[model samples]
Target: MSEQHSGRRRRPHYRALSPLREHLRESFWFAPLVACVGAVLLAGLTDLIDREIFAEATAEQTADTLLSFASAAKSVVSTVSSAMLTFIGVVFSISLVSLQMAAGQMSPRVLRLYVRSRLTKATFSTCLATFVFALLVQLGYDETTDPTRAVSVPIVSTVVALALVLLSLALFVLYVQATLRLLRVPHVIDRVTRESMQVLTAYRWLAPPPGQEAAERPEDPPDGPAPQGPVLLHEGRAGVLRDVNIRRLVRVARRHGTVLHLVPRIGDFIAPGTPTVLAAGGTAPRPRRIAFALNVGVDRTMHQDLSFGFRQLVDIAIRALSPAVNDPTTAVQAVDRIHQLLAVLAPLPVGELRHRDRDGAVRLVQSVPGWEATVDLAFTEIRICGAGQPQVTRRLTAALDDLLRITPQPRLPPLLTQRRLLERAVDAAVPDEHNRAFALAPDRQGIG
Candidate 1:
């Protein structure tokens, strides 16, 4: 019975200790290192106290002083330790008050209330009064024959010890300040706290549904008022999504089901009827693909500004990296296939979408390592192969010709303002097989 009762009490204390331990783990050195530093500081304090009582006076007078002082110190140890422990407690309470002041998390009324707290005000007052009374008595007991050497060593020791205490306290204050700032930062995303009640408390009081089985599903949104779906940034517009975008979609699908039935990633000529999402008994329509300069809303001068040109370049890049793969041997075949399909589907008003196949990577000239990482975004090394493979470097350079062609036009409408232009572009959008000829990764945005 006693053991069970003790265990129950310990469990609550352990829960309270957890966050403090976690905070210290992050803010200070490792636990063993802190312990060693604490031990050394304690030793230094002990030595200072010893020196203050025993370092000075003639050998004969010192002996007498030692006898009296040791007796007094021994007799006072229990009382002084208790009182010092109380002082330490007050220090913590005041330190907390100081923090509240620093953060502007306190006001004048709260400050007055804090001042009246037993630990904050009364304990400090008691310690202050005790120290003054002790000093007066200590002054009467200082029966020294020598003036200079009699006090110098003890004074120096006390000063050093006090300095070390102040240094430690300063270090702790700085640590707390830094930790508070770190906790305030936007990225941490944790709800750690020192209070056990805060920890054990539920976010909501509603009882969880019973049983090991999962909750039942609703087929669709309510008819009374449908909840808002995601707002599209570019509604009904078509442009090839990037490699990083595809993989992110696959990962999101995994939550709904272990197996996702989707078409090839990156550059698979996503046809008009191709579906991007069919999950949770819901379906999403295919995305339209467009080439900006060729599709619609082109200016008479056929010129574009830097920003619009940059957007077109990005679209070209998306088309470049995300092409349909067909195991082509020569660069010419790759380009011919891409040209034929795109010309039939998304007819370019100007030039054409192109492709090139190379045997090995032109950039960095190294194989991509096999390891994968979400945070690092590392993927398999892209290999360029085949004897007739074109120079990836030269082709990449040639790809810039389209950017040069899209000159600045005065009358082009903002894509935002010209909804009809986007609609027309989507209507004319075509899926080119350039994605198939190229080796690219999945999309991050989950757009097919």
Candidate 2:
């Protein structure tokens, strides 16, 4: 009984934590805000300490130190504070320009990578914190008062501000290097590919090992007398369905003795009033509970949406294939990365959308795209957009052939279909026989 009770207690805890984790993952300002608040508190404490210890010290008592050192501290902090403010403006301007270029040249979705970048946020926060700290220290220093009762110059605070200034400069240099790397086409594509592969690996369906006979698909739910009145839950807000907490949903379904069929997959847009789930066999869970399991956001994220990564790469590829850009080599690079990801995904189960409870009863059912849809998502757009470019056609042909060789026999049909489509596209686009043959061949870098 105790064990069962403990198990029941963990579900709500997990349900509460999932949204918090997602928010932190998508937000860039939280960390910087914390850092700035810490800086302000530290500055206040340091100022208090400086006033206590040196408030009564006379120049004669500290003659070993130059009086100019104390007098110049205020001037130095004031000048440094002004300089740091100017530096903040310059850094933000450069960052904005880079973001604009990236959005225009690549895809606007790639801007999220920049917005969530830790280096950019940290550098900006450090500069701002330094400016604030210096200002606080300068305000604490008053040189115009009578010499008999002059406010003590905060030596420690001033020295720390100097160190922060130097640190900000170092961070600025690193930020510049990071920004330059981000601007490079190859680097951006590689990063996007790497992230997509990660998402694939995380959510990939389990499959049998090589040389073993493939297992038969799981049997569908048993047909029985239908529930008299199934409850349909509608979405509360309209947004893209970014992720779902399946485990929590399964647990809730089991607890309520209901079977839940989720209507939308990750990356799907859900409108308010649309039926989001169909619950059979019991009263539907509270709407807020159902909604808690679903993460609906204004924009799609790479959280659990494997398609988002593919979308990013596809956007880049199509942009490159455009007449204005006219860069086939970059398109080829995107194709190569997509091929790698498809190979990773090909062996895995694509439509196994059932989630079972501890007793082995199916509790949650959701729709997922199968292997054919995934293949089309990855290749179809680039193939059509780059049909006129021989280099792109050749790379797509090679990618298809390579995928056919690497993926299991069960995944062969889609690869073959894609190959035939590529052939047809190349035939219709390229009139010259030589160029057509070259495009059809499995050449890695396309025709010379």
Candidate 3:
């Protein structure tokens, strides 16, 4: 039997909606656009309700009472409509400042956190919708010359507008609170760690457990020697390879009687004319079809890139340790989170990169960073940058020691290697033996 027919499929392989969904999630406009449309429709409905029910009902009430109600409601709606514009301006102004501070103080990549915030989107959308709803309600106010004429006071619209105004006020408070919390280093670090943890969970599911990996591995060349076919070059704009349509690639390869090997890993930058896909075996698949199976975007997203999370955390740590910042405590805090993420990743079988169809033939092969590469990406920059800071070095040493205890024997070398390099760095950077010894000591809290 062919290798394709040999092993059991470990996880479900399906096309992801990451391209469209990720774009929409990260965009600041889509949510508000959807809310405004809904608000407009709601405003129209309230106007119809008022014209049909309140217009006739007002005829039965005294003229004095009707006039008073209409005047008061119109006053309220007008105030809310005008004030909502100011509210939007203030909210977004503060948001922009927060983004600027986060970019300068932390990593520019963390700006995505603010943009992708649901509270930020909700607050802006609610303020916008409230303004639209109140403005339309203000227009629905009807005037008449004669006492006998029925007045189509916007009673329903006024009530709905008031409710929207209250919602806006509530969301504004929540947004401000959230924004304040996000500005603090600990909160920001925790949020990034949580997101990375989610990505780690997804990765664990995609890759099989350690013992099962070899048994579940698919045959690479099928029957004969490895065949190499046409290479598909990247076309169009340069971008980071964000995701792969693995299922689609597998289907295409299976149909063509070929094995499709993706040239770039997730998070790799792809320029036009770069080799994207390599076909081997039977007939060559269409280059356009193969390219469509990949999602390349301007920025690296956490959707499928494992290293992106590590990249973000490391960026924050190094930025904090920079001389301009001189914030060693912040760097130590970031290292704490990094240690947590590494703990979660230490034991997993994270190397699986082959995709096979139902028959068990390897249809797609992609490259992924292995354990050593991940360890280096996580530690090398921080180890060098934070070498002089005793707090950061101590914290890093503590983390490495903890990881060494839990990591399998096979994975121990990378952690050991990082430890050796860290010691050399500390010895060279710190001239004083007492400070060097202090930095060498493993302190999980970095001296607390």
Write down the TM-score of every candidate: 0.22, 0.86, 0.90
Cα lDDT of model 3 by residue, 135-167, tens digit: 888876777534456456777788888888889
- Number of the top TM-score candidate: 3
Q: Per TM-score, what order, best first?
A: 3, 2, 1
The candidate 2 region of ten consecutive residues with least summed lDDT is 1-10
lDDT of 1 by residue, 1-448 (tens): 0011221221112232333443332232343344445545544554556455555444335545444443344334334434544655656665575646533421121222232222333333333333333332233233453433343123323333344344444544554454454333111111111111131121111111233112311111123552222211222234332211212333333333322223222222333344432222233222221111111211210011111212222222222333442222223222222222222211111111011112111100001111111101100111122111223212321222222234223112221122232222323332333432221112211122
Cα lDDT of model 2 by residue, 268-322, tens digit: 9887776777787776887678887788889988766778888899999999999
Error of 3 at 398 (Å): 1.3
Better structure of 2 and 3 per lDDT: 3
Which 10 consecutive positions of candidate 3 have the poorest summed lDDT?
1-10
C-alpha RMSD by candidate, in order: 25.6, 4.7, 3.7
What is the lDDT for 10 in model 2? 19
Residue 243's lDDT in candidate 3: 81
